[model samples]
Target: MSERVMPGHTDGLITLGAADALWVDLTTDSAVPTASGAFTSSPAQARMGYVLLGGHAVATVRAGDGRWSVSEGEVRRAAAALNAVGMDRQDLVRIGPFRGAPRQECDEEAPLRWRRRITGELGGPERAARREVGRPYHLAGIDWRQILVEQTRDGTHRTWWLPRAVVRLLDAAEHAETQARDAGDRQTTNPEGPTATPRPYNKELEGQLYSVLSRKPGTSRRVAGWACAVCRGAPATVLDHCHEHGYVRAPLCQSCNTLERPDHLYSNDIRVANRYTRLFHTDTDDWLRHWHRCPGCRARTTLPLPHLAAWTAHIACRSLRPTHRAPRGRKPCGVLRVSWTGSQNAPRSGLLTVAVDCCPSGEHRVLAQVPYREAAERFRIWLAETAPALAAAAGPDPLDGLPAQSRPVIADTSGEGLALF
Candidate 1:
């Protein structure tokens, strides 16, 4: 693998230190951004530090002489940066509300409030490279949580650690969320809030998009006549945005933007759009014609969600009659593991996770979750069509694994499925 590149900040440009720097907003075209600051110490680091440290950010740190003399401007920028990450002013910066210090928010915290959670210096000369013992790649995907950076550039070379209180709060939050989930079900109660607040739109992002469009002559006006920004084939028209956040996501064609829209809409995450498009195309007849073989059993299968349901149901119904040997003796084979890049399942939308593993050992890796309703449809359809065949030789189904169950039977319809009796 190639070594990672660290970027620096150019004048008048706002640097985004997150891994998905491309998704970062630009105030204007003149605010030219560089990748240098993304690696080394910069304002973005402190902002990330403040958040990761659980909102305890002080403007200044103690000097060698033991005098706390950090600038007010630096502190204000730190507060602004913290607020930018989906926090409201009320959640962070406080004014004239404390009993002790006049500037409670700044003075309440101990010295060097912003602390680094991820290990190792970001990057630098051979000395810094040696510190990286498999460093967690600075950016934490679409979670929007940035890595905290410590400004140790000063000759002192001091190291900072998270205060005990902050660690407890983060641990508690995680534990509560975990207990609430039951086999893919969402948390019954949210620690975040009764109803989560909507995030503000990013002007820097808007300007960045305008810059990309304005690069070529009349591209803005020409987009309506061209293909979608995502699939890049269908004619484009509508502007995709989060109905909740009221922010523009992208300029997509009708199909790309319409999956689970309005009610199931996700924020403007780059990965989600890509995943949605992949699953969307897979459901089409064209994609099905090109089949993939499963790695576990080496069986060429159709789209998993439906194909799995179909094959399983056929085996189930065939065993209901008799003469068909029990399949429990055979090994329970054929497993598919699916990792989704995005979803309407809010909390997990941006994070890459294992959505489902079909069959047994989790072998076939798919990129999207199979909708529950669609899977059920395949089972019902297969059982209906194969009812009459259960007695016809009782030939073994290549996919059967589990033994049969006796249940209400559908009338045998192998001939035409038209008997109303």
Candidate 2:
């Protein structure tokens, strides 16, 4: 490798005496030092007095009395320089005025406050690289978190011992760079797509769509006019493709395109008593599957009030089958369903139907029927006052800790288990 260039002047010398010290910058070779008062010192002064240094280096020993007076700033600078060169404790030549400061060498571990700051700056422990003594290696895919730079000399793995504050600063810089790269990728992938906050945008999905569109010019225009096939309301932002068939299925909204997965939806369906439905389109002319949609735009089809869904599912599933699994048809029993009866005007009325069907036969027993407005008010009350008490009773899923791929799929025995509409 090439020699590392150091900053500042590097041709200054320090000469210490009994009463004072002299710092001389070498302007020319002819410039000679004249014998001055108290310039001649004892053997102690000769051994420790003169230090030939690069101009940037500071002599920690006081010239007047030879007292150790090291400033915190100078100590910090020395630490930073050592870190820059990837120098460990063994490589530390000297630091500050205190040459025999054993306590300072032992205090390498950072305090709790700095540790937490470093962790937060690096985006938690998941993103932080584990510091270990090992053979030198290169970074793997998406593994750039090892911001603590290292350098080797004489064919050995060099490690740096930096101050906590300096390490935290390095981690913060890494995080900023990562954020900038992600932002740039987002712009290049989909400049006109939805922002990532309130509505998350999948950049990978958008990039794939752009790649496919580049291969087929007119196909982009055809899909551009199509609405989200899943939601049927939002503008189609991504080209949804089937991995099994390796064919472009239909254009879907950001949410539908990103969140739709058969396995995940199936798991969620089991957990939430099949309240939310996932739509799948096989072909252009194939009958479009429908989920509950808003009366205005027919876009909002996701489960409403998820806090209420868990408790309702728990009670309903138990009442129907006494087991975690629901009955064959997957129709949730003892659940509330709101229906509008009259015209959509001032005189309109609504009904709340509560039904339960436990047996295999397609017969449901209506337990209660009430005005929707009154029932809605009561539902809000129950949600606030009763839900908290039943929260723990809902408990965790049996497959909570299992990996998604390892979790067994609960096969639907009934043919009508999946809802087409």
Candidate 3:
């Protein structure tokens, strides 16, 4: 078999395979001229500086010390060893270097980690205000290995993706910085220069509420039937709408859509909620609290909500695992595009948005914006009419079958008042 050279990198040798990349230590002369060691890869030390992870080698190189460099032949040996185990080179990107992050306090023993604190948008589903950090948080595509390249920076040096933890941590820090910069710019930008003052959202929402109530009462049918998508605990009492174009968005409670957030809703937040309250859910909440793996395809996703138990049983009866098999139907193939039209044609406080990339052939389609309350209520009515038998046939609540540890609960959002977003 002929060897394949990495494109644009003729000098670099690409190994055949590795189940996953491995981190190993070979030796090098330090520019500092301070350390010493000569053991031609000594016997596998039980408490040695490193050990084999799974079936590949991993060097435990501590920070801020020793000759942390290795030779080219040693590099080739490591690569060959990894290839022997089936790790692929195509899955790698040359990200950057492995320098310790700038720090003010001494945290010498601290392994790099990233904590993602979701500062949600105005009218978005508020997760438990969690800060999900990672040193491999089990999100898949994250079980990466660190490959520290030991090379002299004598003009022939290059950077690449830092092993595992630091790559994710660096991404997190950069994202936080970007968010900060954006917030600062928004706060300091000349309001009268180019940015027009946003129209007051609450006033318009109130006007829309009054108009809708004149026809019905309290809230729209969809909004009334489904719990607040944001908090997931309270009954939806308000219709989150687009302030500028007067288009309805989703069903949320006053607590979630509080006036402090004088801006639009978050797309992800609404999408997560819609994933539950819409036709089929793909998130862990309500009926399907934790995500599950598809036995057929191994692709993981959350089941639809408990309220949709009848429907879920219906889907399960069909035994459709589209990710792996054919004939079993999956999510309806279509697109929902919400259009923000001219002021004269705008509905009473709503959002005109569109969803794309839905069809099997990647087709795009447009859907009319309807009151979220109405949509939710329609499903509720249908479920009431036909869900009992289907749900009964489906057996007990799926939650009963799950281990207690796996159950996820909706967060409490009855706090006195936090900034809306």
Worst 10 residues of 1 by lDDT: 89-98
lDDT of 1 at 327: 60
Worst 10 residues of 2 by lDDT: 135-144
How do the residues 173-210 of candidate 1 rate in per-residue lDDT, one tens digit apiece?
A: 22222222211322111222111111222222231223
Query: lDDT of each prediction vs. the true structure?
Result: 0.27, 0.29, 0.28
Q: Residue 238 of candidate 3: its Cα lDDT?
A: 57
Specify the highest-TM-score model's number.
Answer: 3
TM-score versus the correct structure, for each prediction: 0.19, 0.20, 0.23
RMSD of each: 24.2, 25.0, 22.1
lDDT of 2 by residue, 1-421 (tens): 2222223422222223311222211111111111122122111122221211110122233435654322223323323332343212221111112222223211212211222332233333432443343322211000112333334437752333332223322222222222323344321212121112212222323213233654786664444345556545344545654321122445654435433322112211322322223221132112122111111111211112221223233332235432224557454433333222331122126443344435333335444444534443443444335334332222223323322321122333432222111
**Shift in Å, residue 172, candidate 1:** 18
RMSD of 1: 24.2
Which run of 10 residues does model 3 get worst, by summed lDDT?
289-298
Instruction: Go through the candidates in order and give the clash count of each.
Output: 10, 0, 28
Off by over 4 Å in 1: 1-52, 61-65, 69-199, 202-358, 361-421
Candidate 3: misplaced stretches above 4 Å? 1-107, 115-365, 382-421
Candidate 1 clashing pairs, residues 3+ apart or interchain: 7-35, 7-36, 7-37, 8-35, 8-36, 8-37, 25-204, 25-205, 26-204, 49-148
Ranking by TM-score: 3, 2, 1
lDDT of 3 by residue, 1-421 (tens): 3322333432332231211221222112211111111112112221233322221222322234432322223333433433333233322223333233232221212212221111111112332222232122111112232232333345664333322232322332223222323333322212111111112222223213223543665445334445445445444545654332222344554434442231112321111122222234432222221111111000112221222222322232123212223487535443222222222112243233343325454544333333323333444444335444332323223333222332221221422111112
